[model samples]
Target: MMEQNQSGRSLLKQMTLREKIGQMLLCGFHGTEASGDIERLLTEVPIGGVIYFARNVESPEQVERLSKGLQHIARGRGNLPLWISIDQEGGMVARITEGISLMPGQMAIAAAGSLEDAYEAARISGLELKSMGINMNFAPVLDINNNPANPVIGVRSFGEEPEAVAEFGVHTIRGLQDACLAATAKHFPGHGDTDIDSHLDLPVIAHGRERVERVELVPFRAAIAAGVDAMMSAHIYFPALEPQRLPVTLSPAVLSGLLRKELGYEGLIVTDCMEMDAIAVHYGTVEAAVMAVEAGADLVLISHTAKLQRESFGALVQAVESGRISEKRIDESVLRLLTYKAKRGLLRMDADEPAAVAGREKDNAMSLAAAAPEQAERVERGDRSHLDVARRISENSITLVRDEEGMLPLKLERTLVITVATEVTTIADEQLVQAPTLGSALADCGLEVVDLTVSPEDVASDSARLLQAAEAEGVKQIVVGTYNAVNPSGDPQRRLIGRLNRLGKPVAVVALRSPYDLLAIPDASVYVAAYESRPLAMQSIARALTGQIPFAGKLPVSLK
Candidate 1:
């Protein structure tokens, strides 16, 4: 370890100022293929890493080729291996979903009440991401979802209880790291308990230091104790931590004083994207990038906008040249990055071939072997095993919130499954591709189903028409799926449920996204919480509704 540290420092010393500045940047581009602007950025700027979003992903083969191609570009530039990162947190936040294992979100995992399930789910996700050449995962959200109205981090969080979030989060960190994929415990100190999303506007956490430590910082402390590889700083402001009301991403008091000194965190401190509205709209992107590094962030991520990416890199270079930010401080972060890369076997300065330095010779051989017919068959068979784990987690996370009128296990031959179309709630959540609706899942379960899809705006405006539709003569039972009906926008969905209760048809309300929907539609005969609207959760909900499996999940958050 000591020799490795010295070697990393030696490599750090050999870096030019521009190369050192590039090491602090993690950028993103806009393409499925890497031949355009991304190629130029990698060659000219030599960014330390790249983040993959939904737009950059198409299929398993395309993703593998993209990741490998990006690393090859970095190698050609004589740079260390690039950190290929993705937000594969499963559920709605997953970027690569088609061929990879899609596990439940943190809330769903906590709802299942199994620490082993949490660990196993993360392990599966990590292994699959590693197979696709992704080295870092921005995942295992450490936020505690205590607020019911939080738009962005509802089901992304583990649970409301601090201790549960801490325990479950630690297990997930261990799983991802053990799989040889760097796990990032994120949106620190916490993005929960705020109604606003940092992607749009800055949210403030006004809690005192005591409450913040007790609730918000619980999981983060646990993650640090577990030796998590990285942490993504939140853009939310904490009045108790920083007096200036600046987002934590650019606050020296929070990032330097609180996280570095008080917490004694030695790993990388990565800022959430600098282009987010919390920073971009308020502080400007290039200015925030310099402040983030000055604030003790080891990496400043500027995902999207190559113009901003180039400008931020140049701005950091100027900050160092002007002596506003010391070269020693810059070297500190580069050394940390080098040390981490070396520890992960992603750096070997003594090697002549960059492929050997990146340990990609074996990966290249494996890629070739994967082209063989038998290897493809083996890969398909392995995917099944991972899918089963995902299915089990989804099944265990199906919470039967209520059945006061005993309307479960629908005995009716024909049922009306009314599903509200899910809107992209936040920038962090992907626009789901052919997300299975509750009606389709019910149809799969052998019900004579009449399916109706309504948007929240339409439901809010045309509740009577929806009610008339639900009152169709042959439909004996009504199953309505609500996506975050607790929001004021979902009043029409809540009203439609109330009107459906008057029809004498048994009403079973399924909370697809947020479990707190039951709080608004209290009179529904039955209520079930699926936590997410993803395909696996829909399948589990369908099975649980048909009595094929019992609802074994406990509520991870308070609905009352």
Candidate 2:
């Protein structure tokens, strides 16, 4: 029998210098199909993993085939099994949408008021991803949502409190790992307190070491203690950690000294996408890749730009040969990568198999057999039973911040549903097309729903026209779907609400995304914080509006 304790060194000894360096990169490709570039990438360059985005995904079947095809190529090329990763964090940052159950985001789980629920949501999310052969999820964001103006992480966070974040994040990590998937606690030390989105530009976190340890590092410490498989570095600059204000992705002090030595995180450290402007704007792609590895990141994530990926690979190869990067450093990361793959049964390929057409076909057949059950169970995961959890959680997350006039539970008559979401925006990706709005759900509840779509800039004119029509139709009340009413774009919604109030009409405002919307538009007669605007959230809002369900959820985040 083979030894149970096969050392990483044993695996490292079998690899060439080029293969060792190739094991550090995690890249993303353009097409849905297995193109020649991707084939070459897996066979020749042989990156450690590939990350998927909405652009690369079309359906569950497509993703299954894509993942299997990539794995087939990797196995056929005598490479270690690829780590197929995605940001399947549910709510907003979900890459696999159509066939997966879109559960509420982190804050919603926290707001649902149960650690068990948080774990279950993650378990289901992991199940859905693993079914598609995706082994890594860049999820369970350990960031605490302390900043109201946080452009990227609002609902993506668990809550504003560090303890709550730790409590929920730990369970979430357990859930993902339970399903044979690796859970990644991300944006360390923390990206929650910043108001800027790092994708567009770098944001500086000017906290002292004391405050940083006290607040920002709380959940990350908890995550490490919980035994998370991976942690993704944030691109935000920490002035306290390094006087030069280097981003954590390129900071040895942060990644090595703090996360590794201080926190004692033995798992893999994956960098946020190198293609983001936060890193790419300052250091060139090749320079950034070299620096990330030097900074102690086990994996450098370059999610797009194939040209930059090739350049980065060449630069790493040159750096290793020129003694700029020690061979030992390369071995250290490769060991971690091999050890990780070994644990996940990725290194269990047949030795006698040829690395050609026969091998590829056999691997493809095995993958298809494994993926069939997963695809079959896809619809089952989103069945009525699972959706009930969403409904219950959504209803539980509905925080009633204000209802002074108590205009809720409006009778099913002459109620105009004015949803002001001409275009929805999320930090992950700009959603050009609006999803099904709350008007349809309200209409399902027997209310006379007058759905009027309006861009934030056009809200004034749109409101005027809509209100006039409502008045002519003898509409008695208004329900506004304030998706991002706290954003600068929501100025027109505030104006429209003011106009409606002056007209002596009762307005029930639904804060679709963030609970901070209540702070922005305080004058509304009735206020409900749905925490999300997904269909389940819409159903919860509908139920809450018509008095079908009670507002049982406590405010996870402070409105003050």
Candidate 3:
């Protein structure tokens, strides 16, 4: 067993009720630097930490300064250095985009089929983050993507199999924690197998207790065994766990009963963004925050809006004073939070005085300026190595699921490429088109490229019309690239490909996002699941198509 640190215990003994309550709340603020509003929040509410989103990130230097500024203010107020957190889960959900290397996400790593690759990916990500002053990363999603129709967690998960998810998730946690960056296994017990996107609406998992244990909870249990630093609760409702239909974020049956007692996870328990529609549309933000803390969440995340943060903070104080929430409950979570900070050496700062804080800020600025080039050099070296892994992984992950009549290694000299821009929801509920240009990837290979946008309302007829026009111009080889075609609106692309097949033109389907798109368009002459459309993946796809690199990838998830 690990020995408890004296600093955390001593600090806990000295904290007032408001400070302890503040420690439980993870609040969000705007801009890249500490603003007046943020200073006010630190002074009044005095939150435990701040969560950064895409809006808060402008550049790597800005982020380092922003984090240091926040910490400087916190130390000035005689509090523990704030836990600066972010959702840097690469691929679609990367917040720090400019300086950081874009990873092929969880599914690609799983597709690469190497635990070392998973570990390296996390290590590279953690190193970049630590240099930038961010301490915590919400990543290595343990949710197994067993359902093809799952809206939110398709590619974010490692794979469909529980064992693969567990293996990769454990390696990822070790990689992050070893680099001194806290890794959070998220959306427990699991957010997979649901067709709904919880950001827009609440999803319910109808699995019975036995089935839940057999499937959804498998990776979570493995995460606990791996000594994950934190676990983020899902807003999804699981009827088998809680018959009252309360989302797991507010259910003691799942959070306390299942996660704590049954599964034995001793790390910090965090609630997903309370501003998301799953919680916000159903209940008031303050009510939900109180309930989440009551349900055993050590941290309640309010990712946006100052009004909601104030209300939630006020509600927690009132609840503690009115005896609605016990002081012991607050202390339990505060102790865990402090221990985590101490473990990260956040509590190792010198004497907490105004002069000390000012000196620390000046020292940080000087040190950061000096360290910026070294940090940039580290990222440059890491990026080179990581991109090589990405290329090798991409080369191996482009699974040839179906190829009838030997249509692959296409005769690119006579090919016509059509990229279908479909709505894909990666980071938010609002769908954005997968806009990677395939023409450039295949340009040097002598393939003709045509970009076409098909609305969901008229995907079939419009795509067919475009294909017919290409055929009229004597284009025989058809290559169709699609995004989000597997989960929801797949039939349109399938129909368009089928129409080309009927016309005696060989069609090769490249699944830009999900590998399971082959299930919807099974009859294509050839199909390649690229898993993700990162530049390296796209380049690999072009190479695979023209026989420059062999299709070396195997399917991580069974299409059948």
Candidate 4:
């Protein structure tokens, strides 16, 4: 191990200026395959890494092929092994959806209230990602979702409590690292209290250092203590941390001073995509990439636009040549990059070692087949074991907020199920699996069901029609699923529930997204919080409603 580490440092000393600059960049590109611009970047510019989005993924086989092809290209050019990364944070933020374990979101895991579950979910996710040749996962969001009004980090967060978030986040980090995949605890100093999405515009946290320390920085401290491999910077501004109101990604005070010196984190510091509006709209993409590196980010990520990627590479090269940014600073980052790669056993296969590269690929395939044969088989068949784990967690996470009128265990033979169509609440959420209608699950429980799906905008106009349909059918029980109904636009859903109450039928409301929906509709006689609108969650909700499974989940966040 000592010799390997020394060799990595020795290799860094032999690198050219452009090669050292490339080590600081992690770029993204279009298409499912690595060709054209992506191939050119690998051969000429020789970027350090690549991040996968929904656009770059199709299936496990395709992803494996793409990852292997990219690594081959980099190796062919006598460059270091590429860091193939992805945002497989589970739930709505997942990139590789098909043929993998789709674990419950962070909030759902918290609601389940088991640290073991959190660890297992991440371990499973890490193993599968490793099988596909993805070395790093930008995951285990350390943000505590303290603000009910937060648009981006709601379900992605573990919970509102600092300690609970810390415990779960650390366990997730351990799980991923134990599986030999790097886990990134993200969005520091915190993104949990903002209503605005950084993908759209800059958000600010104006709290003093004391308050920020108490809430926002708790999970991050715990993550650092756990030896997390990477930390992704947030685009949100922290007034207390940086007086200039710059995003944390570009603020030296926040990234270098606070995170590095104060917190004592020695891991790789990666910036969130430079193309995000919070950075790009305010500062040019090429400029922000340079600023992020200057701010102490070891890796500057540009997730879209190949033109900007090339420009940013050239700009960084020029920055070093012109003495705007010292070559020594570039070498510092490259050294860190090489060290991390060496630690991960990524530096063993040099360009001359084709047999070693082929052996590594064979090892990955054999490990997948031997260790997780069931998982591999499930990829070809249906109903993966990981889904069973996901379903079990979902079942445990179904919180019975209230059942005032004793409406649970649906006594009626026939029921009416009303569901609101789901929308992508934030740019982070891909909404891969449609939340299956509750009617089918309920029907499987022996209740005759009538299903109705309504758009959020048309709910008010269609309320009367729904009521008439319910009355004409003589339905005595109604179950409605609400998705993020705490927002101002959810007034129609609130009013629709009010109208349904007057019909004299037992109305049970299930919050399919945010658990805070009951806070907006306090008059609801029977309310439940499913925490998410995914298929497993919906099925779990259906089971809980019929008493097939008990509501074991406790509220991770306060309803008040």
Candidate 5:
């Protein structure tokens, strides 16, 4: 088998530089079919593959055509075939939204505490990807989210523990690979600690090598053992790996030294989006591309950089001719790329029935649409006693974070207050509140809520003006939370939290969208996270606010 594989590698070496470079580039094709110049480019440039997003694909039938389009290009570009890929990792990142089983994300699988569920999710996604002509899935995020302050990968991770991500992620990779779709574990060595978003700006991991090995490398190690077809490097920089240099994507120390030599990852090493700020914002396209290849990358991903792709390909061919980048090195990656296509049966253009594909495509979209609503169900069916616990927590947890003057637990008849949000028409937005069923049972006996906007910088800047308007209506205890659902503290939430915190009026903050919102604002004298902002849950909050129910909800995870 090794001899046969070697022979296959030798054959791929005979291909042209253009053909070799084509196998290393992957692009996204929006809409169901690849058409016009894009289709022409696929055949002319013979780029490696396509990555699909939810908008580009509607049902499985569309994906079949999309895949066939790429395959058609491949068949036209001599004998080599294409590799269609997507981020169909289930849950939020799934691109196979057309006709497949829409399983819960890694979080749900982790919550279910079942490997079988994770495996089944992967298997179903793989079957669907295969049906659509997709041979690869950029999935099974191996980041072990250990930081609560992490802005991005929260529930997307399997769980907080490295072992859990490894355990559950392994099962998912195995299942996807078994279904004949190449599964990629990413963003390597990890992207779980930083609060920064790499999509916008580069994030730095200041951790030393020893510390990273202890925590961050856990999931990737397991992924390697699980036989994943590829490992995607992170955009994060590890100084310990390179001493003072490139992020993992362009760092030979991390890619060739650690991943290849130390961990022994023989499979493909695909870089995360080379167009991301970490790569593009810093280095010139030509320089970065050359450095990436020479730094030991087998497949470089340059999403959203067609011009860079052209420039980089031109540079690599020149490098080979000029003895700058050895052809032997290029051959190393080409052989792997070609063998992957062969193993994928891409060269054969399997041409599975279009009718069978059409049926599955419709099924996939319906399943994904059905699963989107499950995000809410997680809390609704979460704890049967959530209402009672919410009641208790809201009532008791309302301690003054900093009551320097001790103006708290407003005396029922003494303190006057009003609330505000979006639904209320204007500053004239005053309505005398009746005691809610639960509120009527508590100390103050009355709870009032008015509506306003917590979005855009302007609304946030005018927060004081808006809140003052409510205060002028003879009010106290400025209770604000309804804006939780709409803006949830991008600009609006932050503005609201800032105004309410500085109000010095015994303000209370209630956010029920993501628990992360609580950490964003100053410690509210009364902070309540209803988990979700459902009206029914808000009704429960009214009761809890008035001491009608005692606060009993324990912290799911620490707010800090």
Candidate 6:
């Protein structure tokens, strides 16, 4: 340990301001394999890490070659091995594919009712990541989906409660570490309650310290207790913490005072992408980086811009010399960082690879998801899945919550239904669509469906009038299926279903998106969940509704 200490100091003394700055910015290298501009950037920019996006991948065999190439780039920066990282959260957010076993989203893993499942997935993910020459993964979203209307989180969160997320998040972290890739628990201080998308605009979590400590902070706290190597800050703002309305990424009160002083999280603290609108709209790139660092961010992520990295680095260097940012503080971060690198066993690896293989993705995701319980449940439930319950509370769950007496199933086969919603643009829309699309399927089933549409500005009036018209036509079943509205329309949808029920017609509610929407329109006599808003999912729901297929879907997540 004494000799190790000496070597650490020597290395730190030799690093230039550019080298230190390079260690902070995590650049993204596009291409199947690292080469050309990637090499130049590694040598000149001397970045500390590289984040892989879908554009950088092909097959898993190619991924190993890509990783080896990045190791080559790191040689120019004093032989410091670059942290090769990917967003491999599985289920929608995966980068490395082939050979590695893939699991469904966190909810599926949590639903598996076993921590071992989470560990196994993370272990295999880490093992594959390591084999491909990558060293880190941005995974295991720890945010509790306390709010079902949250579009960005959905299946990404382990579950709707804090305890479940904490249990699964810890297991996942252990698994990744077991595989040798440093696991990251992300969007620190929580991104669960916001109804605005940080990618498009700034969202504020108005809860004070008490609320944050009780719920949103649980998973992160558990992660810290487990000694996770790092945590990623969110781009969303928490007004209770800062009066300036600064995002957690730029809030010293959060990173320094709370996370460090209260939680004792001594590991690395990384900021989410600085290129995102949450930070960009508020501050220039330079100011953003400076603020992030001053606010206690150990690694400021320059996920997109090479130029912005330069500006941020220049600003930090200036701050150091001018006494605005102390070198001692910088040194503390650098030391912790160096320790992280050492812990990864980088000093032992040669960082050269012409023989690495990467068939992990193909083997992992497709095969594993196909064999998983979620697939089995999907097969069982057919189209009527995701009831926010453990079992098929099925026909019983289609409650007439507000109806004085049950309305009769409509008598007319010539039912007119028009769809008016589109894909969700952001993840924070309060209302989530639970039923699958019933348009073409409705037509194919020989129902004379009359479709209606509503604009964002005129949706309320439009939906109201459309229901009235359906009532006027003596329509049998007015299917209210909207899979694209990602806002909190729980009250409105319930109220609408109530009106349609009063018309004394059978109302079949289909959710093409999240099953959580079913909770809003409890009065619908028959409810079908397609489990997704994809066109295929929509088609599947219609088939299931008409009894073409028995609804075999089991609840993968609990909505309550």
Predicted structure with the largest lDDT when compared to the true one: 1
Model 5 RMSD vs true structure: 10.7
> lDDT per model, in order?
0.85, 0.79, 0.78, 0.83, 0.61, 0.64
- Which 10 consecutive positions of candidate 1 have the poorest summed lDDT? 364-373
Off by over 4 Å in 3: 1-4, 349-382, 422-435, 445-465
User: What's the CA RMSD for each of the models?
Assistant: 4.1, 3.8, 4.1, 4.5, 10.7, 9.2
Name the candidate, 3 or 4, with the larger TM-score value. Answer: 4
- The lDDT of model 4 is 0.83
Q: Predict model 6's lDDT versus the native.
A: 0.64
Candidate 4 regions off by >4 Å? 1-5, 349-385
TM-score of each prediction = 0.94, 0.93, 0.90, 0.93, 0.69, 0.71
Alpha-carbon lDDT of model 2: 0.79
Tens-digit lDDT track for model 4 on 99-164?
A: 777788889999999999899889888888877778889999999898888888888999899999
Candidates 2 and 5 compared by TM-score, better number: 2
Task: Output the lDDT of residue 408, model 2.
Answer: 75
Residue range 1-560, candidate 1, lDDT tens digits: 46556766656655678988898999989998878999999878968899999999999789888987887777766666788888888887899878778888988999999999899989888777777778789998999999988989999999899999999999999999877788999999999899998999999999999999888999999999999989999999999999997999999999889998999988999999999999999999999999999999999999999999999999999999999999999999988887776655566535333232223342211011111111111234138888888899899999987898888897747898888887887899865775778999989999899988887778877776677777778888989999889997888888888888888888899998889888888787699998988888888999999999999999989977
In candidate 2, the residue pairs with backbone N, CA or C atoms under 3 Å apart (3 or more residues apart, or in different chains) clash, namely none
Across residues 138-250, which tens digit of lDDT does each residue of candidate 2 receive? 98898988998988899889988998999999999999988778899998999998988888789998989999999989989989988898999999999899766689999
C-alpha displacement of 341 in model 4, angstroms?
1.5
Candidate with more favorable, higher TM-score: 3 or 5: 3
lDDT of 5 by residue, 3-33 (tens): 3355445455455677777777776544566
Candidate 4: clashing pairs of residues: none
Instruction: Tell me the spans in candidate 2 whose CA falls farther than 4 Å from its real position.
Output: 1-5, 349-383, 422-427, 430-433
Error of 2 at 253 (Å): 0.5
